[model samples]
Target: MHLELAVATDLPALHSLVESAYRGDSARAGWTHEADLLGGQRTDLAALQIMLDDPAQRVLVLRDGDRLDACVALANRGNGTVYVGMVTVAPRLQARGLGRLMLSASEEQAVRLFGATRIEMTVISQRTELIAWYERRGYRLSGERRPFPADDPRFGLPRRDDLEFTVLEKPL
Candidate 1:
């Protein structure tokens, strides 16, 4: 459960881990998957590289030896809050509590690395189970709705036109 700052070396495995955790037939093994709502790739390597290159952001990973078990990205919003995204775990290893562990680590990293006082994330509104999971982790709806990037197939191809995001936040 040692969390480390992701490097360029982690891109390929990280890409696979994320896609498998959220899309395609592989994601069905995990309860947190978005397979029912979206199609295509969850994320791509180029996008991951950009996140890693951003000075105000970091992609953190937890690994077991050579295994890329989990990863989450944190971006310093410069307003005492950090944006959390791409929370991922190995699909086959989901429900084993690794998501929680990654989240806790991300929170600690947020506070320690960016001096953040708050953490925020956006989840698809259609994902009730995932939203509830975050709520149980102390996140609450901010009542703000963001339209899903329907044009951005880089993340995923939406299955429904009503897809949108709900902001979730927690105080550190």
Candidate 2:
């Protein structure tokens, strides 16, 4: 397996992978599924395309031969920190440590490219298990909360009105 920085040309596969890993029935094959909490698609192709085209953002993709096994997006926060998001590993390949590999690669990229000392991400407050997974990987809750965008269909159709995010941070 090898990891590569994704380009705009990878938007389609990345979109499909992100959706399959987080939403819909295919997501159920993995422990990370949010299908029960969100009804709509997790992301759209256009938004991903925009992200790919952004000069300040990079989508790191992990490939197992010809397939994309995992991926994550890293954005420069302009404060010596990198914001990581859209982390996904192929549902069928979950629990095989691909997520950890992608995360470690992202951290390395952040430090090497931006001289960042910290990497941060936001997780849905209700995703206790997911948060615990991150904690096990050395991230900690930063006591910061952000209101989940209720009106943003691009995120997902929240099953409850109380959805919010808790910031998690880890030093590189």
- Give the top-scoring candidate (lDDT): 1
Report the lDDT tens digits of candidate 1 across residue range 1-172.
5789999998999999999999989999889899989998888899999999999999999988988999999999988999999999998888999999999999999999999999999999999989999999999999999999989998799998999999999999
Q: How many residue pairs clash in each candidate?
A: 0, 0
Give me the displacement of residue 30 in model 2, in angstroms.
0.2
- What CA RMSD would you report for each candidate? 0.8, 0.9
Cα lDDT tens digits for candidate 2, 4-40: 9887777788888999999989999999988988879
Pairs that collide, model 2:
none
**Candidate 1, backbone clash total:** 0
Ten contiguous residues minimizing lDDT sum, candidate 1: 1-10
For model 2, where is the 10-residue window of minimal lDDT?
Answer: 47-56
Quote the RMSD, in angstroms, for model 1. 0.8
